[model samples]
Target: MKTKIILFLTTVLLSINITDRGSASSNYFEADVIIYGGTSAAVTAAVKVARTGQSVIMVSPDIHLGGLSSGGLGFTDTGNKEVIGGLSREFYQRVYEYYQQDETWQWQDRSEYGNRGQGTTALDEEFGTMWIFEPHIAEQVFEDFINDEGITVLRDEWLDRKDGVVTEDGRIVSFETLSGKRFKGKMFIDATYEGDLMAAAGVSYHVGRESNDTYDEEWNGVQTGVYHHNHFFPPDGPHIDPYVSPGDPSSGIIGGVSVAPPGEKGSGDHRVQAYCFRMCLSDHPDNKVPFPKPDNYEPSQYILLLRLFESGWHERNNFFTKYDEIPNRKTDTNNHGPVSTDYMGMNYDYPEASYERREQIIQEHEDYQKGMMYFLANDPRVPREIQNEVKRWGLAKDEFTDNGNWPHQLYIREARRMIGDFVMTEHEVLGNREVPKSIGMGSYTLDSHNVQRYITPEGYVQNEGDIGVSPDQPYEIAYGSLIPKKDEIQNLLVPVAMSASHIAFGSIRMEPVFMVLGHSAAAAAVLAIREGQAVQDVNYNDLRNDLEADGQVLEYSD
Candidate 1:
């Protein structure tokens, strides 16, 4: 009787088409190309594929489209504008178009704004069209790409890195998301700054700076001799005391000093540059979100900033410069003076941490930054005039409104980089050497923010690793940088993780460069699919011809 009952239940389950209890049958969604990330590169890659009449899907973890470009980073860092072409140029052109409309400037008049939208001399005539822009305008362009190209975008769907289902043939058969949705594609482009997909695919990548010996390059790690940016106290100014203990060893070093042994000058260490929220602040009272004290606010955290102010180190020049005549009193305030909001040396573990731990770190940074602002504005210790100046500005309400009026995106300047076939070193960037098979070009200054905050031996705080070296001329970005070493991953292209040294990547990592590389990578991916070859095996001559025909610049000029 029991056997019959069990058999009856099994028969009923089968009849109901229930294969496994509480588990839905696995399914796949198909696309010719899949671009992972919501960055400028992801947009360009998807648009390029769609323009070629191929089906493409962009899977982004962001609710918004453009990464930093649309996320309150209005001031663009376009290196060599000439190297920007194809869809990348089209993006800037679209920004120009958006500004041309009289209605676009409801907050400010068009005549008063002048030609600030035209950008600087760095713009390439054949390709460039106004690089600097507002956040909303950038978002509009990305939205236009999606609407016009018919590209499918899955926003807020994060990739499931572990056990994400890559077939044995080395092709990414399908990638499952955290929510159990599967994205199946023939070719994949890892356009994220974090290189999450590339790491998940088991591709080899490097996170910290490679030691000087490892790369045999001059600038790699432990660069104590190099102080490119003016982070230290000016030589002319009265030297600020660096510690709570005067000449005593017990008080500990002032903030922003390296605690570790300087390490091998050229050896690799687990340190990526700094990260900050590119705050869009406004003086307009009606549109400003007044600074609020963070929940975990602590007065002691900002002692260094207070000390700097106490020593008369007051200058607002550290705030990023703006293009002339842009409407709306909004400033793209970046990480300024030491101890001013950038949680230096605290983000080292973020790239590799679990989601829960990353959240904690993000919260910690948020608190540290928010508290810094509040301290500047309301702390009794601050100078009255400085506090008044800070009070004049607040978060832009016209910008990101979802996260309590905070910018939706965190500025993750750099993260895990794929150590692919071609590692673009400083020699390739400084015109000391050239890379073969150019697919794109980057001309921005090799800029790195302070990596560590340590106390100097003199008891004063010192910031290190903020280097800004200009590339005298534009340089070609190697095609090899876009592809993985032939054997690791056959069908993957990493425009964001393109082969480049830390310093070279400092320039190539710019939004404009990423977009250019994205377009090139997509074009190459489509060609590879048609020609039946791995991405590395794609014919360079044919690829170059196609890129040029598509309006990509491969060389740099004055």
Candidate 2:
């Protein structure tokens, strides 16, 4: 009997020990903040939290950082540089530091390189501002932030949306990844462009363009009359013949024109702007990775481009240029001209699709784009000089070598956005109204890439929803946009997919702006944790004070 009792006691003790160890291991992390998404903002937020003496962990799906900032968008779309402040400014400073080294220019000499080396005012690196650069340099800057701030980074850890647990009392008690690794944190931030974690937490969100009637936004959806650029051919000029069949209607509209019924003019639609990989091309013989024919190459895709060239639509040389110091031989080639690059009207279902479906969509876009490039370079229908010029440029050998020299990142310009307490509208963006709880500032032009391609009544192909309206004055971004409705989820904060209409988000989606908001959100989260209140209950005065002290520009004028 004595031996049995001892054995039972030992068994109980061992079980208790095992249980305790499991629980402790599951809840091992106790950081003041945990940021989701590895965007430019995520890096800035992590750095800010560490600077404030709080433990912070950044969980990123991306192996690289800085989103589009370092990805391939070297031409910074800074509206007003004066409004940029704090750690946001510091990031540009680091970009300046990167170019300070003579070794950064192994491909090109200093004399031959143009003014791309002049850094922003904050760092004064004499290198050009932080608007753009090669992908590797951006990655190096993010790596530097991690090393300097001692941030705990877990890369490629996707949140398990279906069963990822969030507690009843409003705290993100624990979240499990696809790999079954659990992470527990006191405060959580949804910093992804898609707002994936926020959605998983049962937070309400809005996808696609809202109707003009819903938000009272003039520029909301199905903007038929608005012509922002020379994307389509004017019938009178040296314009291309707009019809594939001339008089017959069965031949189908050009590739870049919309085929769907144009929904109500002011009503909402499922359409979102197209996305494409901004190919970084080089002309240097030694560095250029020549364009190769994609495996699924199709000649039919380039028919519109060929027709455009034949019709005298000659704006093919509109790719954004960089400074001489940054190697003028290289070009930051983006989606240009009608039927040039943007796979417009094809991404309507991306926001709500399943993960497996999303992967399929991404691949489809890639194959289509790769085939488009191959067609332009090799097809006989292409103008001889245009084909020759296209062949002269190829993918930059130094960029994105992992994916067979294709850009690893996709330009998800806008995705799932939280329909939070205060939805930012064009009224606030155009300076008609002021956002009361200003947490950050955005100065980029109210820009939206073409949302639809349609053939008009005159039989001319047209691209719509490509507005680039400049802000009347530098505007304030509200803190309310970051917080979901108090009744929905009190603890959640969304920096990337914050409350904003589709048109409004076009301005706010800049990479630097995301970083600024990310830092601010982390700061607010830390404050809320310290005060022992929900994020919505945190004192605005205190939050504003901390953000201001940290150099976040809460409000901007002219």
Report lDDT (CA) for all predictions: 0.76, 0.76
How well is each residue in 259-364 modelled by candidate 1, as lDDT tens digits?
Answer: 6655545667899888877777877788888888998788877777777776766664432233122346666777766556567888998787766787787787
Q: Tell me how many clashing residue pairs each candidate has.
A: 13, 17
lDDT by residue (tens digit), candidate 2, 58-163: 8888888777776776656666777777777778777777766888776877567554422332223443445556667777888899888767777888888889
Give candidate 2 misplaced runs (Cα > 4 Å): 1-30, 116-129, 235-246, 252-257, 315-328
Candidate 2 displacement at residue 314 in angstroms: 1.0
lDDT of 2 at 27: 27
Residue 424 of model 1, lDDT score: 90
How high is each candidate's TM-score?
Answer: 0.90, 0.90
Query: Weakest 10 consecutive residues, lDDT, candidate 1?
Result: 317-326
Question: Residue 303 of model 1: what lDDT?
Answer: 72
Global CA lDDT computed for model 1: 0.76
Q: What is the TM-score of candidate 2? A: 0.90
